[model samples]
Target: MLYQDALLERLESGLRKSLPQWGLPQDAKVSLLEISENATYLAEDGNGEKTIFRVHRPDYHTEEEIRSELAWVAALREDGVVETPRTIPTEDGSPLSSFSDGEATRYIAAFSFMSGKEPDAEDDLVKWYGELGEINARLHTHAREWQKPEGFTRKTWNFDTIIGDGALWGEWSAAPGLTEEGHAILEKTAALLRKQTDAFGAGEDRFGLIHCDMRPANLLVDGDRLGVIDFDDCGFSWYAYDFAAAVSFLEHEPYLPDLMAAWVEGYRKQAPLSDEIAAALPMFVMLRRMQLTAWIASHGETETAKSMGVPYTEGSVALGETYLAENG
Candidate 1:
């Protein structure tokens, strides 16, 4: 625990140092917003002007990869494709900035504060999900047509990077509280996912750059605007994977079928959905579930991971069985 505490101290110090790069005053009231893969902070000056600061966890994405992400965000905003927080550039006019954490250099970026709450389950989730679907479809449409900048690079969420040896979040087999029985079930499920996804070939129309983490938690719903956030996971993946990501961590909800149908309806409003792609939605959902299971294991230090704990592992096992029975 001492090491973790020390790490936190360093991060706190780094965040203070980073504010000056964005011209934030030393007296800026900074409060933590969340701690997942990155540490997000809400900083307000004496005048009540607020900015959202994102302190990136090192080694996750290279400086170049981050620039690539910001590039896309700029394009998305400039093209009016979606409503999202605008990037607040540094004093030097760079979209990204960095500070020393004593141990390593951590990157940070500021954004114009977006106002909205995450859509709650009790709310009209089915309706919001329809809007979410339309937003994703529009993003996909832009991704397909936009000309990417030279040397642009972002990781791909393919079979290899998702659950295979190259799994980005970590191996599902290493998940906490995984029982031997559960492991066996997931192994079979993974094998099936591999077989089916291998056949789902990545054609230009079916696969391209996408916002890989479009879950409800990443959304901000005001009266009429659905603002998306946390594009940190945006990259190349199957178009259907975005739908799978849309339902992250809520895989077992009874209203899932209704949500999926709503999403498909909303997506069709913007672009065509082939019968083949439509049929493969469940497979992508299973893949995302397994990926998140691994994420909870590897990111156990985060509150979100701790809250999920063993129940999520067990839930994945049940979902795996259902997926296999239906898809087998």
Candidate 2:
């Protein structure tokens, strides 16, 4: 589900006016890169320097929240915790800039393009997951120690926030292809998950702010350096949720166990991991799949949701059943 022609035209028109405010030349080349949670565009300046222009979806995040996100990103860069693209400010010196068409307001931000290729899923992803684990460990360490600015606000991905009435995306019951059978299986899985997460508890070490979206698509590889992008979904959650997000849509992959082991090993290289946390990896994976199922149902117009359709929801049910059989 690509954006409608009218919506694309309006966004493009806004970009034409907005680029100059970001200090790009009049002849800058602009094109839509992706239209997922947000509409992202690529702008190439006259000198061939590329910048990513992100047009945030309306009502998802307020200006203060977006600023809070950038504040953490800046802290990560300054502390040398991980490699991330740098945000470029508007002429007015505000990190977040916006324009509204009366119908909807689009908050925009610019980031210098970091050069790298996304890892191929068909190729060896275990090694990539290992690197990602190390990176996530560093980020978690920073999140534990870093001081947040006043008014710092971000959504929490706690159990209730995910499966309850106010689920961040939507309830799993509404996901596509969810028959009575599918719902029953997922509900069981969710109950077990709630029990496990509750037992684990949200102690300072186990739960905190995290990059909730850490899939391969959000990762960039340049030689030995692994760079993470797309902090839009960053917020408070179980730290192991990051590992679950690492394997994201690939939960059903046959090599998942190997990938999980690799991630845990890599993570342990930097931070301490308990056997209890390691034992709960499968639960986290199933939880991530269920969350994605709800996301697909709620965001039916996005290309990912449109393409996933019945197969994705059905797969989630299968995964849920397997998780219950093994973990329940």
Candidate 3:
């Protein structure tokens, strides 16, 4: 409820006192530029230096887990697989910092900013499918080093758990955009979930530290190369789920399968995906779509979110209907 600014003041003061390991002067002029529920940013300094200040929700991730994540990112950079913001350390060189909030909450640390161009949003946009694959290959290959944190459950990212939380399915299924085809999608997926409950949770799905939310928005394409950012959602998940998420939001972009294949081939080169994971992708894709729409429907308040989402929400519902009809 303090909004992003109040959180930033506390985060900046901490950064000023901490994070010399990031190679910044103690008194470096820092400015807050980007702030989200899980991240805060300091604008470009006169020397063009910038760093992302972050605070992961403690309800979901622990402080120690966050520290391990940064350490892993630093290690990945050393491996030359992918690019991540360099983690800056506190004066004592610890990566974790805290503002001493209630036991359930804590303010975390910061990292140097990585770079990328904004993805083209226009209709002519060529979704960088193959490049996305290569990037994911590097990400998965690099993520294998970090030990998973405790109580960090693995998410299979299928049709059930994503929107099958019971609380959501009823309303989500009844949302305004349910095309007749969409109804079939829900019905068929429900049946599949019931038939394959145990199969959905397979451990052979190549679980490791996944980028978790590999959306187009979080990736930067410099020339033919791709750089990733925004690790707020990084965690233990099925590798294909990460790949599914990368291509999920890009349905509006051109050439989706091409992009997906590029990422899949690259990831497979590092660690081959099981047939079960490959077969489960469509359901997971639909599940992710439903879950994201439901997230916006429930939490979206800003004009931009609601306004931009109105069309997306409707489009997704429509897509659901179409998938349902085709599968029927």
* Cα lDDT of model 3 by residue, 204-234, tens digit: 3466667777676777767665677777666
- Estimate, for each residue in 1-328, the C-alpha lDDT of model 2 and write its tens digit: 3367788888878877888888887568998988888889999987888999999888788888899999999999999998999989988888988888568888998898998988876656888888888888899999999999999999898888877567878888888878999899989998998898788788887899999998888888888778899999899999999998878788998889998999999999999988988888887888888888988988888887889989998999998898888875
TM-score of every model? 0.97, 0.96, 0.75
**Winning model by TM-score:** 1
Across residues 1-328, which tens digit of lDDT does each residue of candidate 1 receive? Answer: 1226577667767888778887887667988888888888899988899999888888889899888999999899999999998998998899998887667678988889999998988789989888888888899999999999998999999999999999989999988889999999999999999999999999998999999998888999999889999899999999999999989998889988988988988999988988898888888999999999999988988888889999999999999999889877
lDDT (Cα) of model 2: 0.87
* The best candidate in terms of lDDT: 1
Q: Please give the clash total of every predicted structure, in order.
A: 0, 0, 10
lDDT of each: 0.89, 0.87, 0.60
What order do you get sorting by TM-score, best first? 1, 2, 3
Which model, 1 or 3, shows the larger TM-score? 1
The 10 consecutive residues of candidate 2 with the worst lDDT sum are 1-10
